[model samples]
Target: MLQGVAVWAQTDPGPQRIARFEAVEGSIQFQSAADNQTRLADPRWPLAAGDRVWAAAGSRGELNAGGAIVRVGDGADITFTALDERNAQIRLTAGTLGVVLRDIPPGDRFEIDTPNLAVVLDRPGRWRLDVDPQRNTTRVTAEQGSGTLYGEGGQPLAFNAPQSREYAFRSLAGSQPLALNSGDAFDRWSNERDRALAQSPSLRYASADIPGVAQLDAYGDWGNDPRYGAIWYPRSVAADWAPYRNGHWEFIPPWGWTWVDDAPWGFAPFHYGRWEQAGNRWGWIPGPPQRRQPYAPALPFGGARPNIPQGVPPGFRPPMQHPMAPQRIGAPIEPLADQVRRDQWERTQRAQQDQHQADMQRQQQMREAQQRFQPSYGQRQLDEQRRQIEQQQQQQMFQQRHQQEQLMRQDQQQQMQRMAEQQARQRQIQQDQMQRQPMQPAMQPQMPQRMQPQAQPQVQPQAAPQAPMMRQGGVQNRGGGEPGGRGSHGGPPPNH
Candidate 1:
């Protein structure tokens, strides 16, 4: 059945069971005003009440309440509001959300809102959406089947096919379909880190393992968790890293730590300044970790005054020939100050330039989007429609030629009659041509005088003996009348 585009709204109000929420795989650690739960959210996590969930990349948290499973890529945040069983709303504040439907009961609806756009899923199928808050753009890919997109004004944008993607500008009212790629999925996953922390606010934490430190005595017990695989410092440590008191630690699964290991953020740079993990234990490899102090003493300047030469006068100096000259202290002061000022100025300029570049890039993207998304009455779509039409025409032409050949073969009686008539006509033409040629002189002229007188004219050859015309019904004689054989019917005689 063809899918149509239409917009509809939820008629109910207040928090209700619009759909069921579950964590099919990975873990969905939730921390809200009323509840705090962190467990293996496999199979499904039913949302008894409104709660915000953080999903790990490549991991999925299904919100059956909206009939959609928002697959959190690398770092993503998704909030669900079950206004009622009849209608619910989902906001993919950041990252990517993959929504698939098992079976959508009638009157049940799912709506997803992003910073750039919103999608209302009233029909079934698999679809993925990516939200970029930095650039304020939303990208959606219809993986299988299709879905409908509801813009700000509540107009439906229909997308179909196995892997089709579309881009929606945040400030605009419509979207432009884009060529889809798998990498878009990963980009959505990677971009969710900051936004996830903002909504749930618990995912962000500080690292306690600084280099050259024996133990986190000041910030006690800072190490990797054997279960969740991320480095975590207790709230009791420094108050600086603590964002919330008594909140669930939702792990932001980084691409480190082997399948069964329990050390989040991997065993790389996130932990100690210089260390490598070998086997089950972490190893320390040191060099530059200890050398970057702010101040150090040069050898000759060590705490002693130099001895003066015996002849030197009390108020005289060694003509400034000393390795550590007195006047050198203030020399080039202006040049040094100038260098520092230049560095500061350059840094400021660079920052301003960078901001300008970013703005230009954004504007260029918006311009390109506007050009591509101009209101179309679906006229440019005719190229694909035309291709389909031409294909059909070619198929029809081939079928017609095939049918004509079949009909000719089926009429065997007419074929035989046509062949016989053609052959008879050919024979008559040949007979006429033969009759047009005069009979060749039977006797050649004999030499006269010198040789015996020409022999008496050879008996005039009787008109070359007429050949019998063989017909199916009767045999008839055909007398030759021309140099070439001719039939008595005034036509060429048959060769036979």
Candidate 2:
């Protein structure tokens, strides 16, 4: 993962890296840092410190912490104790987890705390940890890298690749290290997922270090522009689809209002890149590659506002504008703030117009009532209007119900027609089989009587009757047989 020193202006605590739910399956539940109530997990929501995730039975969850991938298996529980550019700490309470570390920068820490021991990953590799609460044991298996295990007493036990050990809760006193056992179904699943991520074609255009970039390959196409370089265009979007429109806003701490997109490939493009409108299609520009790209909560229209970090050297200009200013091509780009103001003004005007019309109607009704000196007349008019409205509503409801019934009848007719056709085809197949059965015996060659022994005298008697049957069978076969025949042999049984 790329490590950056730039901090978001809205976030006060420093430059905090945000992790996201890359993949979610079945009943995955999560609790945010600021809330205790658990909710069904959404892949669009970012993961941060103090957040808890639970993969219920028959469920699986995957998280991308920077470049490292953490997969949670069924019945697993985990919490993000700390997550930022410099450190990623996870706490596992029960079940299984698989971690694939792509890179670990210097001075940065990646640790997993189990019930019994703290497993620190010091190198880039794959590791699996399983916790059995009933046994009060935590098993750590280093599939490819080395790490140190710390017990409750702070005793350190160094383990290298291809090693596994089960330690008692809070103690490593007499634990024996063993060879790593063969992985089970969870391990195979994790390996397949890792391979897919590694082979993503979007990685060539977007950085692999950016979480959720792998998901783009299936949902979009990557293209290049002379001006903006590589760009990604999403497939099967609405004609009016725009960035930040299909998603909702949530006030997440540190980042303030954040965008949670409904698309599976929405995270990386919305948070790390800028959008450009070309003709009627929108393309995402991931900007130039940086060793450590900064994370943005939302990239609003007309390019993202500069998120100037604190403690910068002199003369530092943030990359706020896209490669081409006025991000839209072939059209004028409107600033988001100005657009919001215009929409608000239009709404206010509409409201005022509606209110003025209502007042005019009220005054007209009052004047008629006063002129006639019959206040009950106004009430009668109101009642008549209400009755008209009720009649119209009832008419519309009747029309809708009639339409639904027509549709149901049409569907039933089509289904009956299909069944009739299918049955006809089945009968044709059975008739064809019956027609072919009698021809098989007649097609066989008739041997001379001298070729049979004298003990087969019954065959001769049966042969006389078969001769007539063969002639009848041949006549039938001739009707369906080929045009030409071998010496009147009934066209070789119709070349079946």
Badly placed stretches (over 4 Å) of model 1 are: 1-28, 33-45, 56-68, 166-168, 171-176, 181-496
Q: Would you list the clashing residue pairs of candidate 2?
A: none
Q: Any runs in candidate 2 off by more than 4 Å, and if so which?
A: 1-15, 178-181, 238-241, 277-280, 288-290, 300-496
lDDT of 1 by residue, 326-413 (tens): 3222121111223346558877999999999999999999999999887566765777688899999999999999999988887987
* Worst ten in a row by lDDT for model 2: 454-463
Q: Compute the lDDT of residue 284 as modeled in candidate 2.
A: 79
lDDT of 2: 0.69
Winning model by lDDT: 2
TM-score of each: 0.30, 0.57
Distance from true location, Cα of 24 in model 2, Å? 2.1
lDDT of 2 at 205: 73
Report the lDDT of model 2 for residue 110. Answer: 93
